[model samples]
Structures are given as C-alpha cells and as structure tokens.
Target: MNGWNLAAAVLLGAGGTAALWGVTTGPPARRVIAQNMTTSAVCPALLLLSQGYGRPAYVDLALLLALLGPVGTLVFARLLSDDLSDGPPSARVLTWTAAGAGAAVVLAVCVAVGPGRALVKLLVTGALLIGGNIIASRALADGFQGVRGG
Candidate 1:
C-alpha cells in the first residue's frame, strides 16, 4: 500500500475510536479522549508521511501539535472551576496532583505502545484516557467542591 493510504488509515482508525469513546464515555471525558486520539494518530502518521514525502514539514507540524497539548487541559480545568481557591495549600496540591496523574497515565500508555505499534496504541490509549478522565474528572470536581465548601 502507498504511504499516504497507510497514514489515512491510521488517522481514520484513531479518529473513529476516539469518537466512539467520547460518545460512550459522556461529556466529562470527551476532551481528554479526543486529545489523546489525535496526538497518538497524528504523531506516527506524521513520521510516516514525512518519510514518504521526503519533507520534514510534516514532522514539524506533528511536533507543534504535540506542544499545544495543554490547550485542551486548560479548557478542562476551566470547565471544572470558576473559582480560584484562597483557603488552603492542600486544595492546590490536589488539583495539581490530579492533573499530574492524568498526564502520567497518558505518557505511560504511549511508552507501553512503543515505537512500532504507536498508531494502534494511540487509538486505544485515547479511548482509555477518555474513559478514565470521565470518571476522574467528576470525582475531582466533587472532591474540590467539598474542600472549598462549595
């Protein structure tokens, strides 16, 4: 098969799985799911597409997208809160801890998928993250509300 065809398949697979995950998991988890799916699919596809086309621009674009990963995260946080806590350091710690934990899970999933199976791994990882995030986000929002007396 041609390289472009392969890349298209990978992107489609990832996007499809992610979309399915988002639909199944509900709103709380959709963003994380989408982010993971896109990154996982895009990264490996870019690598292949770059090689096939004999151009480095695809790689650059992939890297740029990866770096912009925080945008969805920030949006998620904003959705969870309209309040800035002033009461305790503990609450701040919990917030940071939750974010850190979520990131670590994604990184671990990516590594476990490995270089060769990156695309497949990305698709599954995105779906899993979306599922996990849906549950975790709700729990976090609830916990934070308790801590802040909201």
Candidate 2:
C-alpha cells in the first residue's frame, strides 16, 4: 500500500509538471484548456494507479480513459469552435455518427471486461439512445423543413 501510494504521488506530480509546461507554451485560453485537460488526465490516472493495488478493474478504466482522452478533448474543442454553424450537413452527420460509434464501442468494452451490473449497462445504452435522438433529430427536422419548403 505504501509503495502504491508513493507511485501514485510521483505519477500525479509528473502529470502536474507536464500540465504546467503545456499551459505555459499555449495561448491564454488554450493554456487554461490544456491545464484543465492535463489535470483531468492526471487525477484519473492516479486514481487508477492507486486502485490497481486493490482492484484490477481500475487499471482497465484507466486504460480506456487514456485511450479516449484525446477524443473528449477534440469534442470539447469542436463544441467551442467559432464557426459551428457553417459546417456541412454531411460533416455534422459524420461527426455525430462517429461519436455514437465510439460510445457504443466503449460501452461494449466495459460490458465485456468489467464487473459492472446489468443495470449499469442498460443505463449506458439508454443514455446513448437519448443522446443519439437529441443529436439526429435536429438535423432530421431541418432536412424535413427544407423538403417541405421546396
């Protein structure tokens, strides 16, 4: 336990240092964003590292988060872009589809590998369904409106 705690502390410290460097090199707004992301990454990693000592599941969670971190960050950046209204309809559809696919993949992986309950998996699936509806309904309605006007 002592060793695990020590390792976690060291990893967190290293992550903080990297975050500091990232912020210092980026623009003002970017610096803040980068710092926040780096910090988010670090806390999860440390939590997993610490939990790895008792439960291996945390290690798997950490691995998934590490793999998906960039995707989340990119989504955040896209949401904050200045020209959000100008993207092509096809491009928007592709983006939303890809995000949905990614979520599906994650849910599948968690179900297959983790020790979570059936209810949790069902909840995740339900959330994905809701999210998909929210995203696609807007575009679908817009297309319908366009056709009606024609």
Candidate 3:
C-alpha cells in the first residue's frame, strides 16, 4: 500500500487497540473518555484512508463522524451523569494529542489535494473534529451539568 494507506492502517491499528483496551478495562468515566477518544482516533485515519484510496466520498464520512462524535459523547454524559457527578473526566493530554493528530491529517490531505472546494471541506471537517473533541472533553470535564441545567 501507499504511504497514506500504510499510515492510516498503522494509526487505526494502534489507536483501535488502545481505545479498545481503554473502553473495555476502565471504570465508567475512563471508558467513556476512551470511547470519546475512538472518534478522534478514527476521524483522521478516515481522512488518510480517503486520500490513500483517492475517494473524496470518504471525507464526507469523516465529516459525519466529526459532527456526530461529540453528540454521542454528550448523550453518554447525560446518561451517566450520576456516575460522573463525583468529578469531571479529564484527559487533557489525550484530548490535545487527538486534536493535534486530526489537524496534522487534515493538513496532509489538504496538501495532497491542493487548493479547491475539497480543501474547504477538509478544513471544515478538521475544525469540526478538533472543536468537537475539545467541546466533548470539556463537557465531560464539567460533567455536562450545564447541558443538564445544573
């Protein structure tokens, strides 16, 4: 496979492994954090795979994931509000790391695609992914009490 595809594979493998381990073996808070992480990890890999496969459509899927990831996390946060009420779940290092990776992948894909509408879409997706990651992380940190009117 090409460098892009290979990179995607490697990222998916390592991230998927870590996320799986985290989701399966941790407390409810940690598992939720790890589950949130799964999207951050996969979105960029989806972009990379899109670039590698020469499929612009996959970018759309990435965008969808970027949009939905935080919503899903928020739902989880709402459902488990009691479990998380003790304290917010903060994984700052992992959160920023995932955001950085999404940014890097977006940049790489943008470079490969050059200036065009595609670039704009990629930028939006990246923004959504990074923004969503930050928002989800923060919401979890706050235990989403604001969302629940607390």
Worst 10 residues of 1 by lDDT: 83-92
Model 2: per-residue Cα lDDT over 1-150, one tens digit each: 555566567656766776787668844444434433462435344343534365544544444444455445444334433322333122345334434534454444344445756336434533543344334333422333333323
Give me the displacement of residue 145 in model 2, in angstroms: 28
Q: List where candidate 1 sits over 4 angstroms from the true fold.
A: 1-8, 20-25, 81-150
Score residue 57 of candidate 3 by CA lDDT. Answer: 84
What C-alpha lDDT, on a 0 to 100 scale, does residue 28 get in candidate 1? 43
Best by TM-score: 3
38: Cα error in model 1, Å: 2.2
- Quick one: RMSD of model 2? 10.5
TM-scores of all candidate predictions against the true structure: 0.43, 0.37, 0.95
Quote the positional error of residue 135 for candidate 2 in Å: 24
What does candidate 3 score in Cα RMSD to the true structure?
A: 1.4
Find the 10 residues in a row with the least total lDDT in model 2.
82-91
**What is the alpha-carbon lDDT for the whole of candidate 2?**
0.45
Taking the tens digit of each residue's C-alpha lDDT, what string does model 1 give over 39-148? 43454455455545755444455455444443454454445443323221122343344344435444543554356545454444344434444444344334345434
Q: Tens digits of per-residue lDDT for model 3 on 9-91?
A: 99999999999999999678998999999999899999999999999988999999999999999899988988888767899
List residue ranges in candidate 3 displaced over 4 A.
146-150
lDDT of prediction 3: 0.92
lDDT of each: 0.45, 0.45, 0.92
**Which of the two, 1 or 2, has more TM-score?**
1
